[model samples]
Target: MISASSQQKKQLQKYTMLEGERKQGQFPLLEMSHLLYGGKDQFDKFLERQNFFDTNPMFKVNHDFYNKSRQDQILLNAERTVEAMKKLSLGDPNYYTPNVLCPQGIFISTVHFAMVIPAFQVLASDDQITKWMTSLKNFSAIGCYAQTELGHGSDVQNLQTVAVFDKQTTEFVIHTPNIEATKFWPGELGLYCEFALVFAQLQVDGKGYGVHPFWIRIRDKETHKPLSGIEIGDIGPKMGYAVKDNGFMSFDHFRAPLDSLLNRYIKVSRDGKVERQGNPKVGYGSMMYMRNILCDQYTKFGGRALTIAVRYSLYRKQFKDDNKQEIRILDYQLQQQKLFPLLAEFYACVFGSIKIKELVNDNFNRISQSNDFSLLGLTHAVLSGAKANYTYFVSNCAEWCRLSCGGHGFAHYSGLPIIFFEMSPNITLEGENTILNLQLARYLLKQLQHIVSKPSAVPEFFKFLSLETVKVDDVTTIDNLIKLLGLNCAILTKYAAQKLMTHSDMKESWDTKSGIALAKAASTFIPYFNMLCFLDTINNKAKETKEILTILARIYGITMLLNNMQGLLLKNQLNSQQIKTLQDTRESLYPIIRTNALCLVEAQGLSDNSLQSLIAPKEGDVYMNMYNFASKENSLNKQQVHNGINYIQKMREVNAKL
Candidate 1:
């Protein structure tokens, strides 16, 4: 084994080699990356944010952050949040900067900004905004999105927390009837947040109006104690995303003012009479907002995971070549296959996210301008599938990146494990993948409802549904792969619609029985939509980026094809030779991608401080960095000396005596 001193001495050679590798790229990677960031201006913001986080002592991870206890982490997160907000507000209040620059996963403040604030932005009335927006911005009233209850998550319509409009007092009495009705997993609610935009069943004159948003103050501002009629506390540790302060809260006839109902589009008189002007589904504005936010987050987080995996795979040398020279792990075909496809998928996600966000914004804007919710259902359907598919797939990508790191990936020091914690919960939160598939599947079937009568009225995606016969030839190109995938969806949708029509006699809906088919149809749209978006992104870009991006998009399409092979094969959409073609195409592209692997990851511009991986430093000083990370009180070059009185040695002696 090399000594610590020797590891330090060889670090310079590693840095030189890594610099040479970084300089090997042919494309203008830095300029090309601006497209992923939205534009050059946004990329500049990202760089500035990175510099601030990297330089700020307050933001620094001085020790093993994963080693911190929940309470310690909470304190650290709160402190950093304050400092970050102060600095972020000094010039441009680009709220997105915090989320994009946050080295850690979603934090306490992230929920406030991403969910609660956006919800208010889209849903709150002018007066309501005037009343509460200041409190939210100035940190006088930190807010939590209290939506998911212990029993009724995803089924928002069935939530049990009731806020009844009291006729005499003109007040809404909010109550959580049982333990299961408690708001269970809202971030920032456990300790820090003082307020919540609570979702509860609204009752007026004994008639129920399904779940509606209520502005409720849970804790006192000065003392930070739960209010008289509310019970609030932390939900404790979870599978992942534990760094954020997810918490539980319940109410005991909590009396809030009539104005607290967030009645932007509706009004309630003193006599408990309800007046409304807009669609109630428009109340889903908040949910829609978050789903869009998550689409972008998947790309960013996926990029981070691939950055670590790709960088480490390059920096760490493994088995020797025939010439007795140590070979980089990335030199191997298997490593390239594992990482490059993920790299490609990350780009696809980038393009898809931008498009999806734009679509969501357009939908919201239309509604805001004219109360036009005609396209709301369609947009929601798409978002439901996008959230479910993207989160489920990208979270798995992070895990794949972890696994690709081999045994060392299992270690916390590699930073891949942290990516798992950051990404895994996204699959379940917002909406669970299976349930969301069913939701979108239901919407897809709705489109077929009128297809037989008014065929041309159906959306472009379902245009193939009316076709008598469809034939897709060899899938040599990305477009062909996407067409094959689209054909698979058309088949699944038609099959599902037929099953429903034929089996209307069943006790439950046919969907309950044939849910698997519905989910499969929904899940596989994953690649089709992303491929289209990626191609669109490529078409809009200049020739310089279009070259590298087209190659990446092809690889992404192939990877997605391989992943859906079983479904495609079972559906007869892809034949044996076609599948082999896809495999061959992916393999052919690997070397070309490997040539720019370091360049591609570098394009993501992830700071070493943000990554926190001992294995993924830009300088490529793997051994020395690892040594430094393990030095001092962490585990200095000291003997394994005993405790208080050399008890380990004494125990050995005692064992000998025995």
Candidate 2:
């Protein structure tokens, strides 16, 4: 059972200014507790569940059943989590939300929900869905996603596994031609997954097509051992997600019927003619779908870190004041400076995530009914860029949150370390950030080229891009700042896109000859996309908020523009004085942001319970909980070893001298 002290310790809460003072409003500790529990219980009943941490029915089942039984249990837990996901949808009024469950839990519970079920739901034929969907939903059968290969993870077009169709047997023989073709890095694949949504090169009648997912059995039904022609094993420890059974597999002439191909979107006939529905890119829609959800997922990622950091900040105290009272570290300008900007970013990401979700849902609805999918390609392109930007920014800020808390920040108890570990993997997972940014660059280029070919094709947003030169000559005002931000992004969007098109025919412009060249192209384009993202946020802020946000938007834009300031100077587009003015304008914006540091953080609707760190919580009796925690027997036991050994050695030396 949970001790009273432990229960009291975790009854962490915060209060904020009223809604008139802040947009997202303030959730009191009681309200937050309600929000967390979906209105079922008060503090007393909530603590009761905390007692069963080691053997909670839900928690234990995930480990004992899913982690141990491996394949079958993986599917089981996935189905449970899928049910949980439906319960936890934002649209639901009474969702039982946990504290954002950490990466280990998120991966263990969500891999199947997010990766496997969706692949089958979107890809499988009606008959296949009839056969498998219910079993998948009920957890009688389990599935894992298998697309990333050991050698070619992000490059979808270059995977080496082959599924050649046999006319006589009417089966597709799945084969791993070499060790490099081995499927790797699929979560829960080694032990937990019974079947896999396998992506492999499709060859029929001597004609080859690119990768596609085929549902294939991976383990025996009764024995639970690897099936014939299959080799499966763990990929060993990774930096994060230790509990997740991320694993590797190789197929040796595995056989499945011709009907195994997920034919909802794409189909291979006996004659080898390939028929596809709507857009060919729709076949690769899982990645696109995940990328869309990642915006909100990443916001929560940063919010969790911010929660830890903010709470810790409130709870940590440094030097005593003149009255000999300790001051909270959050009071220090340097501390606020280090963390508040990131706090604002967390808020921006939250709002941005909401927007993206709306966009994705609306577009999906349109595509479903009208079959007009012009937005699918655009949504995919926009989201891939935005996801990369937000994840990277949030991950970087999480590290800074670590530094802000000093020594305790490094401790696992502080929670920043885990948050960082969880978030850092995102830079590479869905799509490598750099390569994905370049994909957005292609979209931008496509738009610019269309407008150039037909001047009437230009979006009104691109009118600034059409200008031969963009000028920043106006006097300073908040309204002007906001306008300039939008204008700046439009110009950059037009310029970069047009530049790529003008240079597209030159082989040297698209050179992958060196890492430096490749990185330059990626770096140049992502900032343009990020600028647009920031301006998009700036446009939505309330008047007073927008005034401040405009400053931040200007700083963000000017920072990118300054990277090529020399080019701007050489081309006579910017005088030295103008560059200095922009720098001064950016430097000035930081202080205006600094004054409202506490209010800004609170406005994000963040609570001390949410942040769960030393540096970011509500201003309070800082260090009381931390000191109590530090003074605990278990916590002290960890530090006791070195102190105890030193004392013993000292005593022995003194006795010998006597």
Candidate 3:
């Protein structure tokens, strides 16, 4: 048998070989990075930030970092987050990337940066901005967006938290009437945030005016103590994101000045007369912004996980080939089957995210200027569908990457487990994926009704619904493939609508019975959008890059079809022969993609510091790097015997006495 020293030496050799393989690719890594980052300047800026983090010990991922107690982790995260903000001058407009504030993963300051601050910017009136925005920017009063209550997560209409307007004091009395009304799972509210953008049902003169956002102080800004009549504390350790102080809050009888109401789209006078302005849907802007952010965040999660998995697969050697030489596990057909398609999906998500973000920004600007709510419905539907789809895809991809790595993936140093845990909440947060998808289905059904009534009046996005049927022969071409997917989407939507219509005019009962069908219908639109964005990107690319992206796009399309083949088969959209053809096409593309897999992942331009995976070392010193890092950073390594040993000894003595 080979000794431990021999095994170590062999692993080093494999690492070196894998490093050599990565360098043998034909495409230029820098050029791909430029493409991925949007431009050379953006790539440079990303590199600069990455280099800074690389040298900062505070950002390092030590083994003990993952093993820390929840309280310690939260405290450390809060300190590091503040220090990062200061050192990086994070509030500067030039340095603002959604990620600059929460560099590694979810941080204590995420809800403040992504939700609270953005909500204030978009929904707060000019006067309110002037009074509170500066303090928020300066971190004088940290804030959380407290929207989800224990009983009402996605169903905002039923939120029990009440805000009654007191015409006498010109104040809003916010009260949590019961346990279910307590605000739950607002990041930073548990420990750090001084204030919150609380969503409560507004009661004016004993009449309900739906849920509205009101700014309320939850804790004292000076002492970081819970304010009088406010009860707040951390909700204990979660599956992941232990550092984030996701907390619960309840107000006994909190009073806020009338000006605390975000009155950009709605206003109320001191006399208690409520005046609604702009579109009522505009109140969803903050939630929409977070959903948009989630689309991009999913790309990041998938990219990082793929980077680690792909790199490790290239280094791990298992069975010997016919030549009696052990080949890298990456050469196995099964491994490629698991990872390559995901790599393509990751790219699709990247492009799709950029498209959705641009769409949202344009719509937001239009709303601010003209209050043209024409595109608001479409934007909401698209974002809701995309967010739900992408989060589910990325979360599943992360788990698959972990499983693909075999035993090492189980170790915390592998980085996959943390990613899996951290991102798991994404499916439930913002909006539950199932509920969000149903919302999209509802939108699609509306559009379908319009199409049926007047095909010419259908919006540009749904115009394809009136097109000619896709022939089986056309499935080989990308455009035809897209048409086929679109056809599937239309069919699914129609089927879901039919199912809903069967409920005998009871809308609530229809929604309840058609939930599964509606979710499935909405999910079909995601790949269609992804493919549309991906095709647009490839069409705009130069010839060389276009060729590579075409291959990736094909892989993505085929993989999506295979994954959803059962639905397509049931709908008669694809036949057995076509399914076989898709399988064959997927098989044919694997080897070609395997040649460029390393280069493709490298193009994402993720830094070693950002990845924080020992298995994905920059220099490809995979085994030794993991060994040394684990040895140095694991707190248990420093101890000769752990406390568990004494417990075992005591149990043995009791058994002997018995």
lDDT of each: 0.78, 0.62, 0.81
TM-score against truth, every candidate: 0.91, 0.76, 0.94
Candidates 2 and 3 compared: the better one by lDDT is 3
lDDT leaderboard ranking: 3, 1, 2
Cα lDDT tens digits, model 1, 1-658, are 9999887777667777777777777678867778788778888888888788899997664546666677777777777767776677622324455454464545457777777887887667789999988888766778899999999897888999999999889999999999989999988888788889998988888898777789888888678899999989888888766667789999999999988888876678888778876566776787887788778755577888888888888877888999999999988998888788888988887788888888888888899888787668878888888888778767877899898888878877777777777777778888887888888888777776657787767777556445333466657566776776676666777776666666766436554677777787777676778888888888866675777888898898887767765555656666678778888988998887887888888887878877778888787667666677777525323446535457877888999998
List candidate 1 segments past 4 Å from native: 1-11, 89-94, 97-100, 461-474, 505-507, 540-544, 565-571, 633-658
How well does candidate 1 score on lDDT at residue 442? 84
In candidate 2, how many Å is residue 289 off? 1.6
Q: Model 1: what TM-score?
A: 0.91
lDDT of 2 by residue, 84-144 (tens): 4543442221122232442324434355666677677677878888989878876567778
Which of the numbered candidates is closest to the native, going by highest TM-score? 3
- Compare candidates 1 and 2 on lDDT and give the better one: 1
Per-residue lDDT, model 1, residue 250, is 94
Give the Cα error of residue 122 in candidate 3, in Å: 2.8
